[model samples]
Target: MDIVGDSGATGYGVVDPHNGWVAKMRLAMPNTRINNYAHDGAMVSDFLPGGRWPDTTDAVRRIGVDQPSLVFIELGGNEYYIDRDPAQYKANLETLTQNIWQVSPRSTIVYETIWPFDPRQSTSMHSWDEYGAAMQQLAVEYSAGWIDLRQFFPPHYADDTYTHLLNTDQIHPTDAGNVVEYTAVLNIINRC
Candidate 1:
């Protein structure tokens, strides 16, 4: 099976040196063809028609209607920057997830929860719990599975350390951190 990973899916580094879930999955199953399209700092809004973010339609086109075996969505963290209204966030996410199903009904869609963020990184525009809950609800509405990444990281890393996921900024995953997140994802996928 071929796998396409999005922003949250792309770990630290150009070669993606860290062992992300995709890397582990590929290692576990040598036959799997895994492609990483996940760009760090990507928002679900980016995949839409005219959003400032990168659009997935091009990526979807790259898949060429053949529909890969699986499409993993790791977005929404950046969406928090847009505004903090949980209801609005839910509506936007609902539309995006539904569109994925509509476009590739046969491919499995995995919606991952945003890891707990450091309050220091974000303005008071929204709360982390609200964003996390909105994502969970979207998973339920779409009949897709949700993976809570917060469970994988050390509890001590919950605060400003969240910003350390990327060396450049607090949002993107560093190489090592990406490996951890990837491992968490792999564990979840293995259970299924």
Candidate 2:
């Protein structure tokens, strides 16, 4: 298995002690080796055509060489934060998945829906609801598996108190939250 995304998949060194979702997934499937190529602050454009970000594009190329059995992608939150056009976001996502297929045709592509951001920490011109819907449609069009984290984390935080699902920053998940993400990925991999 391979993981590609922004801080959510990378843990941004803040929750690294708990290990990211890829590490947890490796522990769950001890026989499997998971490669994580998630870069903090990466957006959908980073993986698109003419994108200058080498880390993401390099990872995609490495996938061709590594040829893992599965690849999980969790990105686009930054695109929303940067106020990218929804139509362009959709196109970039399509291009990304197509690039994945071109590199590792045998690998099963699993597209993770962007998690709902904590409104208190970040503001977005494009709503999480819009991103979620786009992800679902893209997953279907690309014939990839979909892991909707919204099923585990609510779209909005509670007004009364904090939750273990998200960290103090509310943008990233706490250690326990990573466990939730791990479990979700495990379920999807099993089904696949």
Candidate 3:
């Protein structure tokens, strides 16, 4: 399996991303290989021109020439930070889905929801709910997987108030938090 997205998927603020939850997954599977292309501060729209990372031509293109069997995506927080509308979020996700399917027809794509944040402190309020719906719709439309990680962290200003999942930044997950995410994702894979 391969992964891509923003800082959250990169295990930002934690140990080396490879040594993060991805490492846990690797340890558990042993035989399964996981490649992570999650860059820090990467937005869903960054794959295209006019956003940050103009160097990125396309989303799936960053995965190299090898076709991966599975891909887990976690983006949109940076998109929200950029104040992008949900329509654009949906469009970018659509393009990502199309590109991945084209590049790796046999690959199964799974979309992970962004971190749960206080909408009052965010740039746009509707982006969360709207983007979530968009992800679900796209998943169903493409026969892909969608894991709503929001359930793991319903935190607000205080990250560790409820669960010691979020870091002080209230964005990225802590080391233990990464384990939670990995466990959730692994559960889905085991069922399949």
Candidate 4:
């Protein structure tokens, strides 16, 4: 019942991992083993290891060993940040999904949309909505579930914003955001 993904799922913006969504979820579900395999700036595509992170295949192998009941993959922004080609990104993501299914047939996979960050949205790489839609499409294609994290995030341009839900870098979520994220996942898991 743990999770996976990039910096947002890795507690990059926080001082302690215990304050991250994974830890909060562990606290919420004491019986659940939420092993944290996420890394900062992780991509859906298979590639060399990032700082302290194994490549996608190795990571998936490790997670498969755990046989996680539910796998939450929060990805996409890194694809844009790395400026990956859209078609290639789609292929890479599909492959990753297949690998997960091959390794854990009984597991439930959920593809999460990136948060509603305006600057990232304005990038020439790809609109944030485009990424979200791509994730949704893949989720449906694979008969998996999807969660648009944007719904839990307040707009970046509100008159009184910066509710500590996101970091100043505007990429990853903050400690407060981790709380909201845990709530969002909990809600979705309950529904499922």
Q: Write the per-residue lDDT of candidate 3 for residues 1-192, one digit (tens) a residue.
A: 888777777777775555467777888889887887777888776665565664445446755465888888887887666667878888988987777777788888898886576544544556467777878888999888889987777765554365567776766788878887888889889877
Q: Against the true structure, what is each candidate's TM-score?
A: 0.76, 0.89, 0.86, 0.87
By TM-score, the better pick of 1 and 4 is 4
When superposed on Cα atoms, how far off is each prediction in RMSD?
Answer: 3.6, 2.3, 2.7, 2.7
1-192: candidate 4 lDDT, tens digit per residue: 646688888778886778888888888889888877677777776422332445454777776788888988887778777566767677777777777778787889988886776554444666567777777889988888888888878666663466577777776788888888888888888897
Evaluate residue 53 in candidate 4 and report its C-alpha lDDT on the 0 to 100 scale. Answer: 45
lDDT of each: 0.62, 0.78, 0.75, 0.75
Top-scoring candidate (TM-score):
2
Between candidates 2 and 3, the one scoring higher on lDDT is 2
- Weakest 10 consecutive residues of candidate 4 by summed lDDT: 46-55
Candidate 1: worst-modelled 10 consecutive residues by lDDT: 1-10
Model 2 vs. true fold: TM: 0.89
Off by over 4 Å in 4: 46-56, 118-123
Candidate 1: segments with Cα more than 4 A from true spot: 1-7, 13-21, 53-55, 82-84, 119-123, 154-168
lDDT value, candidate 4, whole model: 0.75
